[model samples]
Every structure is written in C-alpha cells, then in structure tokens.
Target: MARPVISCERHSLRGLLAVALALLLVCAVSAGVSAGQAGAQGLTPQQLAGQRVIYSYRGLTPPQSLLDDIRAGRAAGVIFFGENISSPEQIAGVVAQLRQAQAESPISRPLLLMTDQEGGLVRRLPGAPVPSAKQVGQSPDPVAAAFDAGLGAGRNLRGVGMNVNLAPVLDVFDTPGNFIDRTQRSFSDNPFAVAALGSAFITAQQGTGVAATAKHFPGLGTAPAGQNTDTGPVTLPADLSRLRSVDELPYPAAVFVGVKLVMLSWAIYPALDADRPAGLSPMIVDRELRGRNGFRGVTITDALEAESLNAFGTTGQRAVAAAAAGMDLILCSARDTGQGESATTALADAYAGGQLDPAAFDQAVARVDALRAGLR
Candidate 1:
C-alpha cells in the first residue's frame, strides 16, 4: 500500500477544515455572548426604572454632564425656549451637540429635540418665524401657503437638528378673547376650514421629517371667559356632539394625515371630565383621544410646570400622575438649570415606591419607541 502515504493536498484540506470549524465555533460563542448581553439589557427594565423627563436648555453649549445624562438614558427629550436661542445658527449648533451626545448613548433611540415653533408669539426660534396659522388661513390659497409655511418651518427646524415642532394649534377660534387665538394662533372659527388648513400644515410638517403636534386637544378655543388654561382652571362648554363637530374636527384630520404627536391641553372639558384637565383626565386622554379618535400616536402632556398644573400638585407628583393618565412625555419640569435631575429622581422614586404601575410605564415607553422608530 505504498506506505499508505497521504497526499499533501489532502493534508492541507483537512487542516483547512479544522481551522474553519474552529473559527465558526469561536464566532458562535461570540454571537451568543452578544445576544445574551442584549437580552439582559432589555427595554422593560429601562422603561420601568424611570419617567421620561424633558428639560429646557438655555446655554449656547449644553454642559457635558447634561449630555452624559442623556447619553446614559437618564433623560428622555429636550425643549428649547427663547432664552436658549439667540439665532437660527446658534440653535442649530446647540441641537447638533445634543444629537451628537444622543448618538453616543447606549440606547439608539431618537432624542426628541422639540420647540414651540407655532409662529406668531409662541415662536421659539426667531429670524425664521412663519406667520401664524390664522395668517396662513387669511391667504386666499390657504392650503398652498399653509403647506409652504409648514415645509419652510420644517426645513428651518430640521436645519437646526430639531425633530419635533409643537405647532398647528388645532383649537378653533370660537372665543374672540381667548389668549391663544387672540394672538392669531387659531386657523379659523369654522371647524371645517380649521380642519382643512390644519391638515395642510401637519402634512407639510411631517412631509419634511419634522413631526407636527396638534396641540391643546379637545380644543382650548372654547375655554371659559377670564381664564387662560395655562394659568388657571379651564372649562370647555361644548357638548359631545358639538365637540365632535368643531373642536374635534381638526384632530382626526391631522390623525388621518398621520401626525406623530398630539399634545394634550391643560384645559378641562366639563362635558368630558369635570375634575381633571385633558392632560390628566383618563376619560379625555385615554378614552376620548386614544380610544374614541383612534389616535395611536405618542400623547404628550402640556408643560407639567405650567401654573395650571402647579395648583394641582408638585412637579414630580404631577409628572407621575400624568404618566398614569396616559401621557408619554413629561415636558418642561427640569429644575437646576434645565438638568431635570429633580424630575428624573421624582419619577424614579415613583417607580420604586409602587406609585406608578410598571406595566403602564412600559406601554408608554413602547409607544414612544414606536414613534421614534417610524421617524427612523
């Protein structure tokens, strides 16, 4: 048998197969470890561990500690006020830094950079303000102008690294003396017209990757006389039928157009719930908007730090209560120079103390994650 000699080629082939198998085993072990790490770091723990705290930033550059907190998944989102903005370029730079910090975070979720860019008086970024919704409605081609304005606003916001514009006030201008409408924020007293133009605005906004929020839902335009819902108790007088006809018209239109965020009003609709504002009312937030209207989007509470809510409870308590009432984001509660540590600690305490249901918290986090995924 010629010394039973094995060919050099066969020996090389056998060695190659052994090396290949070793490599594959090593790769499989590495993959298993990576997957196990990911499974161990599931979102449920993070979601149930704390509340999503949104704070305002005023400095030209965000502090490194603040950025680190965001990167560590300690903060949820940031809102920029007029004090934080001097010009569009400055705003852009600040937002870029924030986004960069967010990118470096362990979690890859989108960091919500939000502003009240509704135009007119509520505009946060100056030198690029579009006319109010009312002004857009004043144009003969309201749809075209509204669309252009929305596109323009979205472009401006996106230019500065903002993903959300708290805009397109859907409140019908039924009351002439209403502060928001008096400032020309409302589109029209006519529900149909408001619906049409508001939808156009939302379409333009979302068309450019900037999510538009149809705000003060259930309609702040119907707030009782001598009351600004942001400051005091607000009562909506419209019956369900009337609400469906007027105040609720633009919301569904926006929803139909695929709006990503809806901001609940601090205003209380006596017909809907006599005790709590829309933001904290289960009947209104969970039942009316989420259930009745089929708005399967992220629902945010109006600034929890607002005076109207200050009368109800401490900022931390209000935040936990609002989350319980179906709000996904707690905005404007940051203490300590827009750091939001107090609010974050408050939420963490609530979670640990069993005041907030872990399941409910997880659901809200899932909704927020879904919204961010859609953006991606």
Candidate 2:
C-alpha cells in the first residue's frame, strides 16, 4: 500500500518544533564563529599590507587622523621627545593614555612607545633624580652604579607605563669634542669599560621588565671631531681591526646579556660600507650585525628625520629604505617637526605600492611581536 502523503500545510507540530530547533542551533553556531573572529588579536596580512610609522606634534595632543591610522594598524610606532615631556606625572599620564588607546584599537598588539632616555643630553625625563652615564662610568664600581641607575630608571619608566628606553649609548665616545660624549652620554672611552657598564645597564633595565636599547650601534664613538651625526653625515675611517676591537666589542656583550633592541647609526663607516650609512646598509645590518655578530633581537634605525640622511632622500623614502635594509623599527623624532608625519605617510604609501616586499615586512613584524611577547 502507498504511504499516506502529508501535504505541506498538514505538517505535524512536532515536525515544526524540530525544524525550529535545527535553525536555532545553526544560528548559535554562526554567532560563535563571528565572535571568535572579532576576538582575534593582531592584524591580518591585508591590514598590515600598507603601513608606516608616524609622530604627533607636541602641545597639540594626538590628532584624530593619527589616532585613526594607528587604530587601523597603518602606523608602526611613536617617538617621544623632550617636548613631549612636562613632568614625570604628566609623562606618565600621556603614556597611560596612549596604551589605553592601543587597547581599544582593533589591533590587539601593544603600541611601541619609544624615548631617547640615553642620559645626559639625550634624556627625556631629565631631573628625575637619576645619575648620568658619565657619573655611572666614573664611579669606582661602574658596573654596580650602572645596575643601580638602570634599575632606578626602569622603575620610574615602568611606573609611567613606558616599556622601552633608548639608552646606554654604545658609542665609544673616543672623540673628546663629540657632542654626545662631551655632554657625558657615552659610558667611557675605554671599550672594555663601555661594554661592562652597558651590559650591566641592560641587565638591570630588563631585570625590571623595561626593554633597554643599545643605541648608535657599530659605534658612533669614532665620529669626526666637532661633528655630530645627528646634524650631518659623519664618517669614521677605522680599519676592520679597529672596528672589531673598539666599536664592535660592546655589541656582543649587549647581545650576550639579552638586550632586546639595537639602534643603528646614520653615520657612514667608510671601512664598513662607503656607499651607504649603517642605517641604510644591508651589509651592515643584515650581514655584519645579524649574520656575523649573531644578534637575534629587534634592530631599529636612529631617527630617519635626522639631518644625517636629509640629503639622501625624503624622510619617507629613508624610512622605507631602512626597513628594506632590515631595520625592524623606524624612529621619527618630533624634533624634525612635521617631517615625521610625512615620512610615516610615505612608508604607508610604499607598503601600498608594493615597494616593500610582503615577506620582509612580515618578518619584521614577527620579530617585533616575538620580542614584545617575551616582555614581562
């Protein structure tokens, strides 16, 4: 016998309940999937495809345009200057506010807040009751002094919610008239002393959960007399033996002790790379520091907006080139006025135009991510 045919209009109430229940299950599953995607941290390949670093004007507060770019993961980092400082309390407030904005941003990663707290003339938080590197170097026990000073500086910075301190000028300070060293920013003229004090500072700062960066790497210690690399393209005429002995000594010590960031100098080292400054030379960054030196941390460029590279290219072009040359971070100090903004925008444009290779960009982002992830 043929089974009784049930018309659609005559469907049982039980069948209707089952259909409704199935639909509800599907909706619940869909909702979960959407939530998972929303909760994911970091940017997708499409998001970071075309991005760069930017700076804000002091006393003007962070602009909506800059904030929007950062929230969209189009900006890399911010470089703080002396003008960005008011008082320790005020500085702390600004740092906290920046972090809050980052937390609310769609990008889940933390914003890299950088400052040139290298002590003496380069210090951002001056008069914070901390001793200069010169003072630490002059102490009978330089290592102990550096450790204590670094601890104090780290505590003060961490209290203010800052995570990075661009410090412990690795430059040897051989030139007595050198502006950076004449002001006592360098630890010592003796390479061993510099290495010892620098390593101590790195340990002490990182010990307190603040990442310490060794600055002006490959040794700005050998700059020409009466010339600062900040204002011009200074060159050092050291032989390979001199560089290895005096310039490159402190770097290995810094790496061996776990310093997380190293900032490359903009000065030219004819002995190393005559055509390009260390900041823009792949041989210096990739071959020398990364390969020969075996440094596995993040490498940043000194301010691209500095006069050192003003003749080479626009701030944006220099920044893009630095990244291509293997720098993980590009600094654009506000001291350059609006140049930082232009450079950052240029980097964003480069990313969009495919001038920056995707693989290289991803590699940089990954290294930065790893270093930050390991931070306490």
Candidate 3:
C-alpha cells in the first residue's frame, strides 16, 4: 500500500530532513567539546595571569625582560616610579618604547602606563600640574581648584603617553599626624569635604581622557600614631557604622562622579573583616567597596610588595589572594621583575588548577579590560 502512495519529491524531502538533523546534532556536540576545552586551551595561562598584573621595571626604558614579557602577553602594563622619571620628555620617550614593544604582542589593548601622580609628594612624574592635596583641599574654592588641578595633572600625564593617573587620594584621615595627612595626600579630615574635592579631581582627570583613581578605600585617616601599613600590618578600629559614615564617605562622591579605579588599602578593617588586609579581604573589596559604596570601577591592590602583606604570605600568594578577594589589577611596584613574574605564574597556576573561582577571575578580567578599553 505504501509503495503505491509514495512520490519521489516526498521521499527526497524526508532524506534531506534526516541529514539536516544529524548535522545539527554533530555541530552541537562539537561546540560542547570546544567549550569544555576552552578553559584549558582557549587562553594561555600567561594571558590570563598577565592581564591581572601591573608591573614596574628598572631603567628609563622598559627592561628587555619586560619587553619580552609584553611581547609574550605576560605583562599588563608598566608603572612609573621616582626612578623611572627624569623629565616629562624622558618619560615620554620611555612610554613610546613601551608602546613600540607592545605592538609586537598579539594583544591589541593598550598598555596601562600608570603612576602615583596624586599631587604633592606622591606625584611620581616630575612637574606634576597640581599642588599637594593639602594645598588643593585648603584652597579658597576647593572644588574648582581641584577641577583645575585634575585637569593639569591629566594633561601632564597624557602628554607623556601615560593613560592612567593614580590620583585623588580620597582618605578622610582626621587624626593629627596620620600618614595620610602628613604626606599631604588626604583632601581633608572632613568626609564631605574630601568627597567634594575628590569628586572634582575625578571628574577633571577622566574628562581629560586620563583615568583617575580614588585611593586607600574606606579611609586611612584614623590610623593610630600615623601607623604606616607599608612597614607592617595595621588595623582600622572603626566599627561598621562609623566606617560607613566616616571612612567610606569620600568614595560615594567619587563613584557618583565616575572614577575609573579604586585602590584598595592594605590596612585591615576589623569592622569589615578582621583577619585579612582590605586588599586581601572579600568583605572589603567585593562587599564594601563594590557592593555597599556602589563603586563600579576597577579594583586595584595598593602594592603587592607592601610589608603589610608579609604576615599574609609571599608576593605570589598575596597576588593570588588579592585576585580571589576581588582585585582586578595586581600592583607590583617594587622594581623587582621576579616578583611580578612569580605572581603571574602563581595566579596562572591557581586558575589552571581550579584553585581560583572562575566567575571571580572572569569578572576581574572583564573590569580590567573595560577600564583599558576606556583609554583606547
């Protein structure tokens, strides 16, 4: 009966439909396999690890080792320090060489040439445009002055081929002789004043196409005896409510004005998390800075080589911990290439071994890439 009913057109159509279905299934299986292999094969370990690290090197131009690292996609950027500077033109030359080296790498994202150009003593580049944060803070029209200062700083930074200026110290330290105030870094003891001034600087810098960083998050204003975290571990004794009201005040304003990055302090806050430094604490990095304060910018560790992290672990371990804690950029500004290389290696190993949270790593990289994209 079926033999009498079947037509050639209908028989051919059925065969084609069956073939299409098989092909679709095969494609789906192939895609699944590729996705499964992606974690191990899609991105090299160096790429994953290097994307998270910002390193410093010795000499006017980037060292050959650094150039090799850049070419191999094993370095994110170079940070300029006091020794790396002689003049604006000299720094410009060095940055030009870095870009030239980066061109050899397959990664198209521009290297984040950054410095602690926060004005006053912290300004790494010579001839910074703005005066000390104290000078700006105490100015007759602080907001406007800060705006001008930020503009000047941004212009100078961009002039030398640097794209990121780690400035606008947002700490609200009120304690007499605290490092934040003594260094002329904090805008003011008053959080609202700090907020206003910091926002102005952030606005002006980013407006000039140079990204601004609001630093030492949650405040270092109250460190007893002006205790420096760089020499050893220190704790912020303020309770959660005080920290929110006092220490964290400046960040919201900075966030409101669209700061591009927030430098996490190495100082531990018992109110946030008692056991770990802020840069190594999820409660401080993810919960407080990102969640509570609504800072959507990149999260960077202050410096991995800081002695504050000595109690925690070695530089490599600290770097991995910082990433796991939610930091996007690992700052290895101590002038030792080994520290940066070792840290990158450790991070890559951790990610490859499934020691780091995959979601966290992806989010960190996304934020970092997005920030870098802003420079381009």
Candidate maximizing lDDT: 3
Model 1 per-residue lDDT at 134: 83
Taken over the whole model, the C-alpha lDDT of each candidate is: 0.70, 0.68, 0.77
Please identify model 1 stretches exceeding 4 Å from their true place: 1-51, 127-129, 333-339
- Identify the superior model by TM-score, candidate 2 or candidate 3: 3
User: Candidate 3 lDDT, tens digit per residue, 1-376?
Assistant: 0011111222233432332233223211111000111122255877878988998988666678888888887888888988888898888998888898888876777889999888878887776555888888676656556667788888889989999988888888677777877788877777766776676676677767898888888778888764899888888778888889988977776776667888989898888788999988888887898788887768888988888888778888998999888888899988978888998999999988899987678767767766776684
Sliding window of 10 residues with minimal summed lDDT for model 1: 27-36
Clashing pairs in 3: 173-221
Q: Per-prediction TM-score, please?
A: 0.84, 0.83, 0.87
lDDT of 2 by residue, 1-376 (tens): 1111222211233433332233223211111000012222355533453233535446625656556556666555566777778887887777676766666666666767767666556577765316778877776555556667777767767777778788878878777777766778887777766776687677677777788888777887777778877787788878889888888878877776777888899888888899899989999998888877767778888877678787778777887889889887777665543555566566656766789886677667667766555553
- Where in model 2 is the C-alpha error above 4 Å? 1-56, 127-129, 335-341
lDDT of 1 by residue, 135-225 (tens): 8767655555666677777877887888888987888888777786678898777776676667666766777788888888888887766
Candidate 3 yields a Cα-based lDDT of 0.77
